[model samples]
Target: MRAKRTPVLDRACRACGFSDSRGLTHAKLQSGETVTLCGTHELMLRRAGGAVDAGELRGVLSDRRDTVRRSVGGGDELAESLQEAFAPNRRRTERRAS
Candidate 1:
């Protein structure tokens, strides 16, 4: 028999632990974990901390979902590997543009 598994939550708020597939913003933490934040929580993360600013960045996997309402495939291992390989170049270009 197949082992029981819990379906992954498409969105989970890292701040308040709220979770839903809708109204969630996907972002990457400074520690590199991908987390979903609601509008309320996203605002909180943008604020300055005690002495430094938050190091989080909104991920590319977000916004398009709500803006266009399209489904995304996360099971493509080869594609994910390729993306990771070029991540450095992508970051450099982004930095230059900014």
Candidate 2:
């Protein structure tokens, strides 16, 4: 006897419209189910907190609120990461203006 195959949930990429066949990858939810998404979409999901449902996602956000607050309070590594991520774009724009 063979076990049945589970279906993969298909989600479009948030950044580009690349469909599952092109760039989709899987993300395991808290519920243990997997969702298939493109690379761009996966990044978006991570930013939003991967959750099985909206309520679960909300709870994850609520649970992280304190951590976020503390990180933003001072000496945050997040600020540095954000700055590094945007610095290249800032330099490009400055070059364009000059």
Candidate 3:
């Protein structure tokens, strides 16, 4: 029995290492190999005579737009929390002079 191939959900872009899911897309090359790509690389592929699905490209672009919109709307709070989480340890370790 042939093993079923599972779709990769967390693949990094082939041309660039942009792993953000919001702007990532998959394309099947004429050589029958599937590749993950960021929006820029996908457009490059299309411009270089590669076939890209119009519907899929539109969906990816719309989703990316929505993500950007949400980020612009309320990303400050999340950014602050992340900053606090990754901030250097501030507790003093030296013994205080009595």
Candidate 4:
């Protein structure tokens, strides 16, 4: 009987900040392999035609919004600012879902 094969574990580069959960723009040290990056890094990679999975992008955006909200103490004014900054993107994402 043949044994089941285990999936290879993917790791992120701490120096370059790559991860499987995020999206990748450039090829990794190993040719033909893609590397995932955080939102901040993704934006930087955008110019290079880097793309992220919509769901992952949304999660990152939400986390960033939440971080901003918490940093501002989650007050009405802060929430309003965050909404102003992030609401448009949220709306766009929702519209794309339809």
Q: Which 10 consecutive positions of candidate 1 have the poorest summed lDDT?
A: 48-57
Q: Pick the candidate with the highest lDDT.
A: 3
Clashing pairs in 1: none
Q: Candidate 2, residues 15-88: lDDT per residue as tens digits?
A: 34467576777766778766555776566668876788544644543434245453445556888788877887
Please give me the total number of clashing residue pairs in predicted model 3.
0
Q: Assess the local accuracy of residue 45 in candidate 4 as a C-alpha lDDT between 0 and 100.
A: 43
Q: What TM-score do all the candidates reach, one by one?
A: 0.34, 0.39, 0.43, 0.23
Q: What is the C-alpha lDDT of each candidate?
A: 0.56, 0.62, 0.66, 0.47
Model 1 over residues 1-98: C-alpha lDDT tens digits?
99998535345675556777576886545565555677776665555221122233433212333474454556478888889868887777566433
**Mind giving the per-residue lDDT tens digits that candidate 4 earns over 1-98?**
99998544335532245575545333232233354455465564454453344343334333333353435455588778887878776667556443
Model 2 off-target regions past 4 Å?
A: 11-17, 54-98
Model 2 residue 83 lDDT score: 86
Q: By lDDT, is 3 or 4 better?
A: 3
Give stretches of model 1 more than 4 Å off. Answer: 1-10, 49-98
Clashing pairs in 3: none
Give the C-alpha lDDT of model 3.
Answer: 0.66
Model 2, residue 22: distance off in Å is: 2.3
Stretches > 4 Å off in candidate 3? 1-4, 7-10, 51-98
